[model samples]
Target: MVVAVVAAGGPGPLINGFGVDTSCLGYDAHNVAQGDADNTSHNILHTHSNKSRQSSPGKNFPLQNNSIALEIMVNVPKERKTYCAGKCKKHAVHKVTQYKAGKASNFAQGKRRYDSKQMGFGGQTKPVFHKKAKTTRKIVLRLECKKCKTKKQLCLKRTKHFELGQKAAASGHQY
Candidate 1:
């Protein structure tokens, strides 16, 4: 006996062994002959037959958009600890500036010798010295508000600089 399979939706394409055309009686014969086969087979392939929904459109365009230009200023943090006691603030600052030089070696070596002497077992022990590294660029900026007689200092780090740029872009401003 010839069996027919019909889909619930209007006539379109034949999916698997079933067709959607209601004009054909093949679906009715298949349902009567195969019974549960019609239901199980159609459910397995239902997902492939469904159409996808389109995404919603975005909002209206922005107006008065202006490019945001930033001048990043990097500075040392306040309340930082000093390497040695009784050293003048200027000396501390100078040491940080001369970080690239090997001047700090003497101070580091002196501290190590003092520590080893306190331990009382030192004989040609390795000298603990600060390794000379590259110097970082410092930022300086002075910001004044025109509306009020208020002035403020601003410092930007690497992460803060990128965050500022992202904020500008999110606000519909060109960065």
Candidate 2:
């Protein structure tokens, strides 16, 4: 169930109905050259009401206005073939997993001070951030060498959807 969508302008990688060839979604090069923000600069989304025979709207590709749908195939297996520094060789099979943040410590100095300040405060003391711009986070992959067990971290480009392992067949292979 792959959906095919294309933008009107801009130089981007070509993608066929079966697969995506590049990681980039199309964008206006003129706007990008002026240093404008990415998502807020465009609004080219439209739904074709006459195309009722098509499968669910973007069942294969999710669509958003002014934004291009990037059909990146990022589903990686739990193991990978790459160079391992510990073994000092290439073609080493490394175990792959998502990196998770460690638990926050209650005894940290900042936490203690914030806790005391909020105990009898008339209003909130610290500022909370709300003006977030980016829609997706850069995924981090944790790799461990099977032989030496040396661990390493790799960061991927930012994207809206990310999957760790091979998707099940029943899910329609939407990644």
Candidate 3:
């Protein structure tokens, strides 16, 4: 049978046809090679071949299970070339911007109804909603055609941080 060992920065090892992570066994490459190779769920049995092999407590092991704090941000370009269904009706350069809601109008049907109902009210007519559960709002990209000045919006997934064509320089050494 074929036995393929996987380490960090490499794809997971395939025991049979499925890939599996063996780093959770608290064994590094040095101990892994000296121990008996067991492809079944990383239950390794340590058997030193020679007396010269000694475990070093000072050696650092690779981080297991990918427990790293990652910075995730959604960044979109300031300008994009896309289809403009306006006067041009063709692919053109579109100015990219973040979509934001405008001020709510008090003259709206709901607001008008609420305001009229609130007149000489005994108490609050409806229960105020306070159970907020979401942490982030879905981002929307406003695309305006440079030629036709046509505006469109593209919806994106939820993100904590959003940037437009701004790339921060690496502050430290990047691997």
Best of the candidates, TM-score: 3
lDDT of 2 by residue, 1-175 (tens): 3223333254432333222222245544333333346542452232233345657655655554214423454677899988887765666889999999999999999999999999984888889999998877778999999888888999877667778887845655555
lDDT of 1: 0.38
Task: Find the candidate with the highest lDDT and give its number.
Answer: 3
How would you encode candidate 1's per-residue C-alpha lDDT over 1-80 as one tens digit per residue? 23234444346345445454644332443343245664645533223434465544322323212112223333343322
Candidate numbers sorted by TM-score from highest down:
3, 2, 1
TM-score of each: 0.16, 0.52, 0.57
Worst 10 residues of 2 by lDDT: 14-23
TM-score of 1: 0.16
Q: After superposition, which runs of candidate 3 have C-alpha atoms over 4 Å from their true positions?
A: 1-71, 173-175
The weakest ten consecutive residues by lDDT in model 1 span 91-100
- Where does candidate 2 stray beyond 4 Å? 1-73, 87-91, 168-175
